[model samples]
Target: MSVHAIFLSMLCILLGLAKPSSSATDTFVFGGCSQIKYAPGSPYEYNVNSILSSLVNSASSTSYNNFKISLPGSTKADIVYGLYQCRGDLSNSDCRDCVAHAVSRLGVVCPGSSGGALQFDGCFIKYDNMTFFGVQDKGVVMKKCGPSIGFDSDGMTSRDSLLGYLTAGGQYFRVGGSGNVQGVAQCVQDLSMSQCQDCLAEATLQLKNQCGSAAWGDMFLGKCYARYSSRGDHSRDHDSHDDNDNDDEMQKTLAILIGLIAGVALVIVFLSCLAKLCDRKGFFHISSKEDPHSLKAEIQEDRYIEARERK
Candidate 1:
């Protein structure tokens, strides 16, 4: 397959988790375009779409981007409900986008009158035809730690080595926030405090399972993180590095790669390009006035004007 096709296929199949319909009361309805399925004995099989449509519409009406609705159907029980929270630092746009994506996945991952969850890095959405919204269910949580975090480095100090994950209450956090790393927690704002806590705890377990002994990964689906070390926080580290020296490093590496791909000398090409750019106007004017016969002079006054315009 072409690289593009392989990339797309991998993305489509990535969410491998499946909670098969083992429950006598459960029905799994995986979503596909315009496809519909019904629980074996559901008295209101036809109205399932109506129930989902109304709930989604209502959610859109409110600012509840991460909202979900369930229908118990009159013969069964009250529809279960759930919504999740993206990382709190995410803006309104991100929250809305994440929720919408999660909702779409829900139809595919969990269809029909059964219970299921659609998990993502930003959030998780779930529902059953049962009342799960207000209740805190610990049974749903999953956890895994870096069971194989062991590694050895020649120059790195013991303190800088990759370490296994630890819980929030452990000695890992005993230092009480001495670093740039900040602990983050998020939940559907509608969740009760206890419910939020339960959700976060559950998410921690799931992260442990997925990441194994890796030094870092998502703490859980859209809930919270309770490990240690901000230095290993790639998100923050990457963002800060973009400001200056790191940007140059990236540009240099990119220039080299492009040169190789295009069968040209990358460094020489970049330097030549830069030199031409500088020689544009007052590119290398040196003041012979201040220093006797200095090779460099003040930049041509017009070049400053051009630089300002570029900015």
Candidate 2:
């Protein structure tokens, strides 16, 4: 194998998607005909069912829809059928825009192809000559941006630390990860946990191949994103909701004591870590802790693995 291939394979091991068993196909794709257009004849040229058209453009930041084409006079399919899905986390508006771009661009790039899917950072859309719901497909195209920087020689250990943290569902974590390499993983919604892990694993490997040794990098796909950055964030503010809820609040500090304690390092460290996590990708906040109705993206599969196992 080439260097890129070797690096990619190694990365896959790190992310936990190296080799997964393919299970028998047991997937279902539902609803797709409302927003589409079609013909009115007995022999359809794959007309979009009214049901499908209505549903295709209906993803409310967390769903998928179907699209189709038909002959001018036929009622039966003579041409094509397909489905689309935006990332489960995107707002409906974002999903709609992404689909419009993806579909229009797909025509320019691969005209007449009956089946394919396009994924943007926030959405994914797939169509095929044959039905494609619930079928496991690694054939979707994926891309990654180069890492922004490099790792310390100590970087490899941190990388492994993150990998272990994710794969073992945080079992191998050391809580005092005060300053460690930053890493994140995500997978499509429909996948089983194992399948999601497998997808993450593949994406991790792809990153290694594409951005070897770079400091900041990401594996981007139609369905998910896995990324890492080298900037050690040790001082982040955490008490956003209640300014008085500081961990240091218990310390009896006369105004003078507070002034005297201004240079303390622990306060800085706690603040930094807290600030970095709340707003970043890969991290998930519990619903009750944060506003449940707030419009945040869906937490990825890997993030849920630990919570799921704990239950």
Candidate 3:
């Protein structure tokens, strides 16, 4: 293959091998598109793209941000409002990656919709023509309850205590463990503390009432979520641990592949540079019998003779 083609092929392979920040975090929890569709190439479509781009860009710096987009002279219907919020525990880089994934998935899941919402394990994103920011929405968007453990009193007590602790915290994100139960709760940053408390209260209540004696449960409200896992009592925890292990192994394998690809790419670059250098110096057709140093000397002597002849 030509040197340029080889280089391009190597580059494509490198890019294809590159992995995202965290597959577990990028796992799709839920997504929905609006029933209302915007005309393709319409002004509203432009605003939607702009707002989604803003959301992805802003995620690198902050865990939560809201954006409003409206061009001058555009009507209110053409405006777009959007926000993205990453899980509190994620690093800025991870948050950026998660939000980017969510944004890309939004286009696939909610193509041309005037409104959409997507929730991933690590981030949440939503956009619409109407205003929804800072508005309290306690409506349940998702609920999952693990297999029932037939009412272990101690496990139930631990789960209840953890949920209560999650609600008592004033921060937007809370995590706690009680005995064998691990719990986490978070509300959108725009909510006031009281609003967050109310949201979590509703979420935990749902978990308690709907998932009674369950080994694990999740309650996702419009603006908040609460989840708890009872260790050693559920398969979900074990499955998650196995998934993490697999992810680690896959990452290590990818790292080795990247290293190998990068090495090959460097070698190709070096050879290309050397070939260019040789071609520029007129060294492409040196006789096999000639020493390279002697060839260089002969070329210089020929150049000198040519200069003398010209004079």
Candidate 4:
């Protein structure tokens, strides 16, 4: 093949390999749609689409953004308010991808709803006809507690300390570890600092009061969430064993994927080096005979020397 053809082929292969992995960040946590539905071709639907597009576009530049959409002739009731917030640590590209995915998912999960909300592990998106911006909503949306292993005073103390540290932070997102316990807390950026603190405080309090003695716990309120996990706690249940097995399988899958990607990258590099060598030697035309001075013959000789040197 020509050098240009080979380069194009490699480019295609690299592009295929460039597809991002399905991270835990994109995992669906919870979502809900309003009971009210909009007309099929109404102004409300148009505004919803516009606001969702704004969210997807803005996510590429910022981790948190809110948009309000109202057409020139649209009424107050037709206005759409929407917002998306990615996890603080995610890169802009990841944030953009996550928001796009969430937008697509919201359509499928809550089609034509006047208002809807979706929360993934990495981000949150919400839109509505009525205003919810800068609102303080402490209502519990979701709560999960891992299987209890009875009461361990030390473990509970560590969890409490870690949670306290998370609540004390003034940032929109906070993470900390204490002993064997690790915890994270975050609030939507629309809230004031004090409101964010109050929301996290409420979430952590729920985790403590409701998830007592559990190895892990999650409490998600309307505008904030808190979660914690303690190491070295194993549940004595068949389900927990199954969960552990699933985790192990996931790890194995990730390892195999990484290995394959590395192998492909090495192949691309080798091919690129070979292309450069061929260009330098003006060996565009393939030679059928095993001429000693040919590119193929030289490559083989170099490999032979390398193998011998490795011994």
lDDT of 4 by residue, 1-311 (tens): 75456655755665565554576567788999999999998888999999999999999999999989998778888999999999888899989999999999999999989999999988999999988889999999999888897989988898999888899898999878888888778899999999999999999999989999988988999999988887532111223567568767766765676567667767878898998899789986564575757776878999999999999
Candidate 4's C-alpha runs over 4 A off are 1-21, 232-311
Collision count of model 3: 0
Q: Which candidate should be chosen as best, given lDDT against the real structure?
A: 3
Better of 2 and 3 by TM-score: 3
Using lDDT as the measure, what is the rank order of every candidate, best first? 3, 4, 2, 1
Tens digits of lDDT, candidate 3, 1-311: 87567766866765666555456678778888899999998889989999999998999899999999997667887999999999889899999999999999899999989999999988999999999988999998998988899968888888889999999999899888999899788999888899999999999999999999988898899999998888732213635866778768876887777677778878888998998899889988666798989888998999999999999
lDDT tens digits by residue: candidate 2, 135-222? 4444325443433445555776665566445443422111112135666555555455666566566666676667666655556554
- lDDT tens digits, residue span 251-278, model 1: 5765565445444344556776787788
TM-score of each: 0.42, 0.45, 0.71, 0.71
Indicate the TM-score of model 4.
Answer: 0.71
RMSD, each candidate, Å? 19.9, 28.7, 10.1, 12.8
Q: Backbone clashes per model, in order?
A: 21, 36, 0, 0
Report RMSD for candidate 4: 12.8
lDDT of each: 0.44, 0.48, 0.87, 0.86
Candidate 4 least-lDDT 10 residues? 231-240
Q: Lowest-scoring 10 consecutive residues by lDDT in candidate 3?
A: 232-241
